[model samples]
Target: MANTPAIGYKFDDISEINTSKDAWAVVATPIRLWVVPSFSGKKLPYSMELVLMDAKGGKIHASVRQSLIYKFQPLMNEGRVYQISSFGVEESRGDFRTTGHGYKINFQFSTSVRLVKDLPINRSPYSFMPLSDVALNNPDSYYLIDVMGILTGYSEELEFEKDGKKNKKMTIEIEQDGVRMECAFFGNYVAEVLGQIAAGDKNNAVIVIQLAKIKPFRGKISLQNAYGSTRILFNPDVEGANSLRQRFLEAHEPAAQVLNHLPNSGKISVSDDFLKRHWGKTVEQIKNMRANLKPSQSFSIPLEHNRTIEHNKQNALLATGSWGMRAWILESEVCLRPPW
Candidate 1:
């Protein structure tokens, strides 16, 4: 698959299956999506395509793969290509009822659109160097940060589809500003950030965004660390131009307040006796100590899987750029290595 020609699409990744002519006998799973573009503060969802494309760029007969009703769902409002939602792996056999006949990969849905600029940038703005005497705790403000993190835990338990597809509905835990917060990914819309962020990495950039208060649930006593329990769709112009990094760094420049002042937002001190410190304190206590660094300082690696980001990056650059599905276990995972 390394030699597979790159296709032009928004997924930024792709995975091809190893199949043969025998695949035609198995049922092709179909997916239906509702597309909605917000206009005037209201959202309207509509149905779109039923596509059947072969690996060689030919259209497969939808009826032969599944019932007429199941094979004819819309492609999408944005006209993205469709893939098997859950298909059988039976070889030259039409046995929907047989075990070992097939398996499933979670169907993925995505839409790539440019931000209208005026469209609100969600989340908190910069802190630290860009700080002021004013404490703006509004829930709807956006922030500028270059730091990239990963989803460590989800509030809701995850569920898989019939054919072993991964359907996860959970809040992400992003380690930002030396703290972790609850983030979220919706339905099939979770954009895979495989190569972008790692577990304990911190990269800074300049920015001007906002910070706001939020409550994950009702009756909650204290506020949450999340700007919102929302998966923010970053503006491509900013993401592509590295403006997000720029904005994040701008916030950390020396100023009225440094991030290190706060216990949770401060830099971590590393020492050969790091484990000795843990003996006398609770995890939270030691964590708070680490967080209480001066704004000018940084933190230590908190997770052993820190290599997650770099590992995914090679996988990301190797696949085709399509927004629909990000293939993780594809053979091409080994193709794209960074130049020394």
Candidate 2:
């Protein structure tokens, strides 16, 4: 039971605790383990043990206290995700002969926040972060190889595990004229590149790389950016583009909260005249704050002047000019989506 504390969890921080630990030591232990997540709570006072993957820094387990159920007894269906905040624990006292040895923990659930999804960002595996932050109007029709700069140098490297239990990961860094970003040619790709580097300097081994949605940091450009690049697909890696798109969708899929927080107020029967008067003011304020021009920031504007104003997520309620383009304020710039 004393060793149950070290079950399977590793503590992130242990600088705050004052405790003496010895190998095969029989000592008093803390029995409570706490977890913060949106729990459906079908299993109350559940029988669970923490596994200590590391003897150096193991995580604490504070037994959960049904503070909510004890107070109001609301019906919480099992299988729902919950987010929790703070918690605590309890230890065993009594001696060996009379009461025997045992310790129990006490945990508390603080606030309940819903989970959200990621945003929609598309890109490639080889192009994980390969896009350079450049503007191209007719991007889709061109070859990305003609896009980015040349390759400069590359080096073989190793990726190490924290515990030193696993083998060092074999890696290579392909340096382009931009930033020396990495492209992994795993499995068979590793063997092929190994021979090329070993044979001589593969200095002339130049490949055309397409750049998109590149976030700038200093002057050194990095290859293959995922977000904002919009997954510009060129030749040789068209298959990779599809995979990149999937990842983008997965990463940026809106968190439930982000979507729910979107302004669902305003009216439906919005006309141009109504939009002209109201949209100008609202759009003006949004511009001042420098909100990213997203579907959420869109307002209807008529060809003649500012017309009727109706706030909504999207529909005819939001399109720009005849191009059906919607203004998006990203980071802090007003970017038009489906720009024509």
Candidate 3:
């Protein structure tokens, strides 16, 4: 008998696949994969969502229905190369679409998925939007975006009742190139971000949030998590993060050097003589002084205790300005006994 030749299957580019095709095959990597829950509040699995990227850097959203999740979940892994074929193609529709690709893949019973031992795609799957541009984003925008910045501050986790269920939320402030923006994480994401901060250094930590939605809350624009699709990375070891860290360091190097060279570098003393000179200044005057202050220059004004301002034993206020103008009250005996 003559030797039989194996049949070859052709793969289509992610960008080329559309609803017009019945049989489609593609070699792509699942950059992100997560299970979505039912919107009916039944606490049941709805479907498995994935953001897949081809070797050419084209990305498309893919979904495995709740019933087929068991069959496909085991066969696919994030960041791993796979040969997927015979999947259904449909028009992408969602209030918060993960990708800009007009079409998305729908895994069917006959959908074939197998692991490929080839090297995965090396290109970055992120198209990060600048913090400055965030304000310009339309609140009703359909597509989600990726963003990375330095974690400057965060609020306490708050619990609230919604739909007769308890939900948690936390707001974090991130800054990039002197521009600051707030992002709110809800549900399990509250714990996820806080856990990462606890595990690592939270000060000036580089945080990368992928597939974030731009939302308007209380008449202010903010970034928010898009259910299970949002991925949070803290101090990620990537090119963008390294570059941001480098820029931050370079910008603050002068302030850091100045602090290092100062005698008793960690402590600032407010003498009675210093307090006497600033004691009579009103809060408005102090605000004006701060407004006129130059970089790396600061002025301190003693606040009058009218039983309104909270104070500890020391009661000292220290105002300092560096690369970024920062002011904070310090605990010192000088503040405890103000010179009238």
Candidate 4:
């Protein structure tokens, strides 16, 4: 008997696929995967979201929704190539689109997934965005972005009560070539980063975060971990980390030298000219006015009353400066520069 050769389904490039068809044949590498729990908090009703990259470096978003989620969840593994068919295609929606593709996949009851055991393509595509251009592309206000930078500074852990639960948070500031960005991590991430810093990891300066959400807080843009699917790498095996670290080292200065330039005194200066112009009086005249200020003389002893009035007068003199400037003076006691 003559042997018959089996025919494989024709696969379509992810970039070229759209919502025009009800079914598609897609063969792609799973670069990122996120499993979201159902709304009711049931285990069986969960869904999977993934970003798949094609051979030509094209990337698209695919998802396993509802009833068919359980069947395909176990089969799809990140960093593997699979030829999927009979899945529903629809227009990608929402403010946060993981991929730029106009269409995304929806796993149906008849969806078929077959993993390719033989490995040939090894590298996955990564579209890392620079910190400067983050504001331009992040206009939609909720897209997932990938960023890599050198760690410049971090803040102490903060504990806050939200919804009757105590949550821990930490903010890490990173810089790329001079541009700075801050990202806050909650819960386990706080511990994870603190541990890495404590261990004195050499690669602590180089950080790469994938599937991070862009958030604008108090007039500043912040990068935040998107939880489940998000991955954080310190000194990853990729060349990008090494390249950035080298650039940082070449331009880096000694820690003490950098710290010396920081402003240690009050930023606001009350000049003699400003006092004369605004208050119609000179600095010496103001000093005399404060010295002469007195409190109500009562049954209290004269010395005790004099002390109380002196204390109140000093407070009033301090109050002349703005609240923020007052706090700065108290902390560093940095003398204000005399504006001649």
Candidate 5:
């Protein structure tokens, strides 16, 4: 049972409360948390933002001003449920309201938070949008989406400028049920991903992001963090993460086994044109090229010719022990490279 409420306090659903009121009890889970620092990069009274979901399947944005953060920070834990009361309510602003609710919670120093024990935490309150349904052609600019998938790969962090402002972003590739897509994380999310990779905690993990905005690039849809409203959970202790991990492992096992026997399986940098030319071409296509070959030339002659211009690149990558031409060698009848 939850802690007994104060005498005058009464429970209220987050969906029902709109105006500035007092003494309403609300039991909700804190799904997301963010600390906003002052503009000068100083710690001058940082404010906090939270996305909370209640038992009745209602979600709303919540805020704790800088003055009260110190008093409430210790009591607030993301993913934990609490019975709270005596908080202010204000009409949620458009840019800040991630949920559809008309109002948001405003916590004060006098607000009370009593942790609710013995109940299973409900981490996911919204239905997730599949990668297949999201597309660049979709007209909904403000649509928020959730995604759960396996982290297949990632690119190096890129810094670029737009509108006379510099920003950092990274592209993350995620796959679900044979569908692969890219998502971009900006600012703090970028730092979080880099930190996890640095700590080696991202080796075999599923990433789940909530409330991401879908933006299109080059005719493809890309998910981006929705700033204050988005929540990211990496390898969370939830059933969805476990299921994704299992599926990812099962799907990659065959490739993993092949890599285990092949020491130099790392990819060498190649242009998109190169991959688009060779990656999906059947062995028959290369075999057909045999007729165009000179009588004395080996079947690998064309491949070697393609490599001639990239000789320095090949040598550089090979010297660093990261290039693997063996896969191509094994799959092809080309006699140019020695059998590994």
Candidate 6:
């Protein structure tokens, strides 16, 4: 037997609630929650963002503004079902959208929340978009999406100044079906990825990034974290992750076996034939080759040429280990030397 609320309370479907309705209530579980930073650069958070899913599997984005945080923050809990009423409904317009619902819920001062224990609802509400589909998506689209794939490679943490404060960023490459996509994570997200890499085997690790924004650079598309809305999971114990791991291993077993036999040298070596062909190339020629170079590949340049490249494009040159091994790695920006 399931427990029910009072007879006067009628739960409305998430899809049915709109601004037209005078009173509405919904039984939904908060699947994802994050605190949005204040846009004004203040220390306090601007609002609490959430992705809620109803018993019918309908999802919606909800927000508790800063002013009302004290009142509602204590009552809300992630992964718990709640009966909510008296919330405001408004058009969901933003560069980063957590859900596809036409409208979003806003917690008003008069809003009510009650814990519900008997609702049968799906807890793992993930809608993963394929890597190939992400490449075809419009870069300027406002709707953010979820993605899951095998973690192939990642760049070293890069630090820079943003708004007079030091910030960190790291770029990672994920692959599926021979199609690879570059994803950049900033701030704490970079640490999260690094921590996961340190804790587990990096080879064939499954990664899931939720609500990532599509970005286009040069002629290719990539993914970037959408501020506080993005959620990252590394080798999570979920159905989607398990399925991806099995498929990737089955498809790439032969390739993996071949790679296992290859030398595990920390530095990549270039063939004499490749060096002979590219020797004495101008910096302009190297810039043109950026589009063709893979993230994992690196090429060497003479120490004399380093000064010329640095003088002309200082921002593009990320001085790495040493001048003796002037190996440049290609990413969104070229590095003067290999990270190793």
lDDT accuracy of residue 119 in candidate 3 = 44
Every candidate's lDDT: 0.26, 0.30, 0.71, 0.62, 0.63, 0.71
Q: Candidate 4: give the clashing pairs.
A: none
The sequence of per-residue lDDT tens digits that candidate 6 reaches over residues 1-340 is 1245546777889988778876878888888888888878898889998998998888899999999888888887788888888899998875577778889999999998888777657656787788888787543346778888888778777777755778788888887776788888888998988898789877888888888887644446778788888888888877767777778888786556221211111211233222332235544666765545565654444532133333222223422221123435343444443223
lDDT of 1 by residue, 1-340 (tens): 0112223422211123324322222112221122223323344322222222222332221222212222233322212333233332222222111111122222223211121212122322212221111112322111212223222332433444533444544343432243434433334433332122333222332221112223222222112222121123222233322643443345445451222211122111222123222123333443344445554554333322121211221122112111111123222322322222
User: TM-score for every candidate vs. truth?
Assistant: 0.22, 0.20, 0.70, 0.68, 0.61, 0.72
Over 304-335, each residue of candidate 2 has an lDDT whose tens digit, in order, gives 22344333333333334222345544434445
Q: What is the per-residue lDDT of model 5 for residues 89-123, given as tens digits with 9 covering 90 to 100?
A: 88765423467777778898778788876544555
RMSD of each: 23.2, 24.1, 18.5, 18.2, 18.4, 13.7
Scored by lDDT, model 5 comes in at 0.63
On TM-score, the leading prediction is 6
Using TM-score, rank the candidates from best to worst: 6, 3, 4, 5, 1, 2
The sequence of per-residue lDDT tens digits that candidate 3 reaches over residues 1-340 is 1121113757788989888859888888998999999877676689999999989988999999999988888888888888888888999875578888999999999988877764467888788888878876443346789989988777777777655787888878787887777888888998998798789987668999999987644345677798899999998886778788778777765443221111111111243223332244443544445555555565443332221222222332433211112233342112233222
Model 2 residue 96 CA deviation (Å) reads: 68
List the candidate 4 regions with Cα displacement exceeding 4 Å. 1-8, 38-45, 135-139, 199-204, 256-340
Model 1 misplacement above 4 A: 1-181, 186-235, 239-244, 253-340
Task: Please state the error at residue 211 of candidate 6 in Å.
Answer: 1.5
Using TM-score as the yardstick, the better of models 3 and 5 is: 3
lDDT score, candidate 2: 0.30
Task: Please identify which of the two predictions, 1 or 3, would achieve the higher TM-score against the true structure.
Answer: 3
